[model samples]
Target: MTERQLPGYRRIANEVRAAIAAGEFAEGDRLPSVSALAERFAVTTGVVVRALEVLKAEGLVIARHGSGVFVRRFAAIRRSSPARLSRARWGTGQMIQDADTEVRPRVVDVVVAESPAPAWVAEPLGLTSGSDVLSRSRRFLVEDRPVQLAVSYYPADLVRGTRIALTDTGPGGAYARLAEQGHAPAHFTEYVRGRFPSPVEAGGLELQAGTFVLEITRHAFTAAGLCVEVNRMILDATAYILDYTFDA
Candidate 1:
C-alpha cells in the first residue's frame, strides 16, 4: 500500500511493528528516536510520536521515564472471559485440586517463602509493606502441554494454620476450603496488562522467545469488601484466549 493511502500515524506504526516482528528491533531494543523516525518516514516529529503512541497502546513498545522508547519484550495477550480457568469459579486450593483431577497441572515449583509484599499486593491485601505473605507458584498443563503459570499470595496469618495452606490435595480446592473456614470470597477485581513474560516465567510456561503473554492480576474479596487473596496468572497467548459474557 502507498503511504498516502494509509493514515499517517497508522502507516508509521505498521512499519515499525513490522520491523519489530522481523527482528530488526528485538526485544529490549531501543526504537529510533522520534526525530530519527520522522526523518526516515519523511514526516514531522509529532507524527512519529503519534505512531509510537500506537505501539505503546498495543504493548509493543514501552517508554521509560528517562530512557527513550524501547521495543517491548512481549506482545499484549488479549484477555476476555468465559474461559474454563479453575480460579475463575474456585479458590486457589480448589483450583489446584481440579487441575490435578481433570487437567493435571505440572507442579513446577511450590514454596512457602517469607517476604515483604509488593505495593500492588500490599494495598489490596490491606497489609502494610513488609508484612509476611505466603507465595505459591503453580504451573499447569492441558493435554500434556504447558498452558498457564500462576503465582498466588495470601496473608500468612489468614492461611497459616489452615489445611488449605498446608496440603496440596486433589479434590477439595482452596476456595472450597476457604468457604468451609468461613472466609469464602464472594467477588474479585481483576487488573489486566499486556507484556512479555520474564525469562523465568517464560521458561516455566515453555513459551517461545518472542511469544506474547497475558498478565491477569486478581484480588479476591469477601462480601464485606475485605480482600482475601491476590493472584497473578500468566497464559500463553496462542494457546488460549480469555473469554467472558455480560447480561443486559
Candidate 2:
C-alpha cells in the first residue's frame, strides 16, 4: 500500500504488534530502523517513529540507548479483567452533569513550580534527563467527600508564560489550553495500571481498605508527533467504569 493508503502511525503500530505475535518478529529481534520502516511502508520517518512509540506504550518493545529498538524479551502485559459495573463514568467525552449531584471539583491549589519529573513522565514527554517540568496538582471532591487527585506535568517551555501556565480557571481544561496555544493534540494514548490506593489518596478520597486505584498515564501529542503533556490521573476503583459499544 502507498503511504497514503497505509493508515495512520497507530494503525501501523498495531499491524507490527500483530506481526510480532504471529512470529514475524520474535523476542530479541531488532526492529527495522525508522528510515527502513519508512521506506518499507512508503511512509515518512516521522510516521515510523510514531509507530515505535505505540509499541513502547504497549510494553512490547524497548528502545535501547545507542542501540536499535528491539522486541522486549519479557514484556509484562497488565490486562484489566472484566468486572462488575459501577455508577461512575470514565472515557474521553464531555463531562456529564447531574443536578442532584452535590459534589463538584473545587480547585484546592494550583502550583507552578519547576521540578524534576519521574521517569515515566519524563520519558514520554521527551524531556531531558533531570529536566524541570511545570507540575500542577489538583484535588477534587464528590458530595463534599474528596474523590480524586490529578498530577499533571508539562514541559516548562511550552507553558511557562501562557495564561494557563499558572491559572485555575479555563475552558475545557489543560488539553484545550495546549490546543489553543497552537500545540493542538493530535492523539492521546493512555496506559492504565491498577494498584492499591495510597494512604494519602485513600484518605483524601475516603476510599476503603480494599478499594483499588486505577492509575492512568496519558500522553498527549502534537500533530507533528511532539509529546506535549504527560498526566497521571488516579481514580477510585468503585468510582468509575469504562463503557463502549462493539459492532460485529
Candidate 3:
C-alpha cells in the first residue's frame, strides 16, 4: 500500500510492473503514450486508462487495434499430456496442439449443439440438471492471439451419429471417434482451477483483469464406467506451460 498510498489504478499498475522487470519495458516496447502516461503520472486520463488496464491485466501490456500500447511477448505453451494425448495427435483434423510451436492453432469457431447441463455442467455430466448434453463449442487462435476455450459434453445418446455429432470431430478426435464408437478413453481426469475470467471465459480467452484462466475440468472415463467426455478447458493464463510427464 505504499505506492503513493496505492489505488490510483493500483498506483499506475505498480509503476508499470516495475517498468517490466527493470528492462525498462522492452518486449514489443512502445508503451508511454496515454498522453504520455497522463503527463508522467500526475494521473487522470482516467488514471492513465486505469493504468493501462493494469498492464493489460498483467500479461504485461498489449492493445494494438489502432496500434499503440505494446510491451508483450511472453508467449507460453508447454501443455504435454503424454504428447498431446496421442492416438497420434487427433490423427489428422488436428484438434489443435502445435507441439513445440511455430504458433499455429487458429480455430475460432465450431458449434454442434444440444445444451441443458451447465450447473458446472451437471455434476461432471452424470447429468440431471435438465439432462440433455452433446454441446461441443470451441475457439482457439494463435497468431491472431485469442488462446483457447474448448467445451464438450457428449451423452446425447453418447455422441449420436458420431463425428461426435459432427461440426467435424473426425479422424481420431473425440477420443479417436470414441475408439471407433465403443467408448474408448479408459481414463482421463484433470480438474485444475483458477479464477478471474468468465465473462464468457473472459470473452472467450481474450482475457484481462488481473489475468487468470487455466480451468481444465476434463473427465473422459469409460472402461465401461461411462462418462464419455466432459471437457471445459479455458487456458490463456499468460498462454500456458502445463506439462504432465507421467511415470511417477
Highest TM-score against the true fold, candidate:
1
What TM-score number comes out for model 2? 0.55
Give the alpha-carbon lDDT of every model. 0.73, 0.68, 0.77
Relative to the true structure, candidate 1 reaches a TM of 0.60
Candidate 1 residue-wise lDDT at 40: 93
Q: For residues 1-248, what per-residue lDDT tens digits would candidate 3 score against the true structure?
A: 46567778887778777878898888988887888878887878888888787778777888998879998888787677667766566655455365645565666588889877877677765778878888888888777778888888877877777678888776556788887777777767788788777687887776655578878888878787777788887888788777776675
lDDT digits (tens) for residues 81-125 of candidate 1: 433334444544344334233334455555555577888888899
Comparing 1 and 2 on TM-score, the stronger one:
1
Lowest summed lDDT over 10 consecutive residues: which window, candidate 3? 91-100
Kindly report which residue pairs in candidate 3 clash with one another. 198-201, 198-202
TM-scores of all candidate predictions against the true structure: 0.60, 0.55, 0.34
Q: What is the C-alpha lDDT profile of model 2 across 1-248, one tens digit per residue?
A: 66557658977887788889999889999988889888887878998898888787555788999899999886222222121111122122223222113333455555656898778878988877678888888765554645467778889888887755666525455666676688877666777889997898887666655557878776878889999888787876555443333359
Worst lDDT run of 10 residues, candidate 1, spans 75-84
Angstrom error of the Cα, residue 194, model 2: value is: 1.6
Instruction: Rate residue 119 of model 2 by lDDT.
Output: 85
Top lDDT hit: 3
State in Å the error of residue 124, model 3. 11
